[model samples]
Target: MEFVITGDGSNTLYHPEIGEHYHSKHGALQESRHVFLDMGLHHFLAKEETNEVSVLEVGFGTGLNFLLTADDATRRSLQLHYCGIEAYPLPTDVIFATGYHRFVQPATWAAFMQNYAQALTTEVDFAEHIRLKIAHEKLMDFQTDDQFDVLYFDAFAAIHQPEMWSDQSLAHICSYLKPGGIFVTYAITGNLKRSMKALGFTVEKAPGAPGKREMLRATKVG
Candidate 1:
């Protein structure tokens, strides 16, 4: 993996094996804030009246989404519980080297850096209102009774990891979302919209981040 400075002056890792960057080259921080935090979490929070929110993130490569969401929740005094599923978790050093700390609150960055490894083994309350757990397993093997209010589908592009975007995979993942839940991703395609509709989500086309034309912001339909 090589560190590349994005157009927005943020750092994102380029994976030689996958032939993909962990985040958008247009901007790492911008993409996370636009697609996940703003479109996914914030939209849900505004529509639903709740003191606590549950978020499930796929990929979970650099934990940028989680950090931003946690920081946002802390400021609002909202309780947030997040779960990230990663088939191959990054090393502690790689995470520390991402230079992502410059974007999040210092306290949040410190807590995440200190408890990241522990979160891989078990859920940890790293801050007064933030709890995180990283499932060190493939997405299919993940089992949880908890149905999330927001789902950040941050997997690699379907071109590189087709199986992760297959109809069956989409169904299995969406099954974990409660009715009226939010599901957001940085990519939008005809196949994706069809799959989300078939799986009972009211999908919409949202404005994309800097590099793309559009994104998918879907709400689970009963």
Candidate 2:
């Protein structure tokens, strides 16, 4: 993995093995904020009356999504339980070298890093309202009885990891969502939309982030 600076001045990792970047070359933070935080988490919370929100992230990559959600939860004073599943965990040095702190407030960076470190081994309560758990497992092998209100499907493109976007894999992931829960992803392929619809989700196209043309947002109907 190599550190590459994105268009928005955020750092993303380039996986030479797969020839894919962890995030968009256009902008790492920008893409994450637009696709996951805005379209996934906030969109769900806006219509729901509860102060507690649960999020399941498909790829924990550089912990950018986790940090963004943590900051948002803190600002809104919302109770957030975040579960991140990653098959190949990045090294501590790689994470630190990404310089994610530049995108976050200085005061919270220390605590976020500490919580991130502790979260590797076990779940950690990062703040009064934020709880984080990182599971070092592939999405296909992951099993959980817990239901989530939102899912950040930040997996690599289907071309790179086709199995992750398979219909069966999607159905398995959708089974974890509570009724009416939202699922958001950067990829907006025809097959993906069909897969979500077949699994009982109300799928729609959304404006993509800076570098992309379009994205997908789906909600569990039943």
Candidate 3:
């Protein structure tokens, strides 16, 4: 993976093997903020009056989503339980090199860097209000007794990794959600919408980030 400066002056990694970037080339930070943080977490928090929330993220590529969420949790003094699934984790040096720390609170970034490796082994208290864990495994093999209130489907696009967006894969992933759980992603396609509908989710197309025209947000009704 090589770092490339996105259109918005944020950095992202280009995965040569996958033939895709880790985030939208339009803007890495903007994509994460728009899709996962604002659309996913904020929307859930807005709907429910709660002091705590649980989120599950697929394709925790650069930990940008986690960092941003942790920052918001700190701001609101809200307790956040975050879990991410990454089939191939990045190196510690690479994560630190991303310069993503500049985008979040100093404490949030420090705590995350200190606990990132440990989070792979077990959940860690990332901060006073944040708990983090990263399951270093494939989506199909990930199992958790805990159900999440929000899910961030941030995997590479179907063009690059078709298996990750397959209907069976969506079923396995959505099964971890609570009945009223919210699912958000930086993608919206006919097949994806149909898959979510078949899985009992109320899906809607949301405004996309800079490069794309639309994204998706869905609620688990089944």
Tell me how candidate 1 scores on lDDT: 0.93
**Model 3 TM-score, 2 decimals:** 0.98
Candidate RMSDs in Å, in order, are 0.7, 1.1, 0.7
Clashing pairs for predicted structure model 2, backbone only: none
Question: Pairing residues by index, what is the TM-score of model 2?
Answer: 0.97
TM-score, every prediction: 0.98, 0.97, 0.98
RMSD of 3: 0.7
Q: Write the per-residue lDDT of candidate 3 for residues 1-222, one digit (tens) a residue.
A: 799999888999999998999998999999999999889999999999999999999998899999999899999989999999998999999999999988988898889789989998899988877889999999999999999999999999999899999999999999999998999999999999999999999999999999899999999995
**Global lDDT scores for all candidate models:** 0.93, 0.89, 0.94
Q: Give the Å error, residue 87, model 2.
A: 0.8
Query: Between 2 and 3, whose lDDT is larger?
Result: 3
Clashing pairs in 3: none
Model 1, runs deviating above 4 Å:
none
Model 1 residue pairs with clashes: none
| 1 versus 2: better TM-score goes to | 1
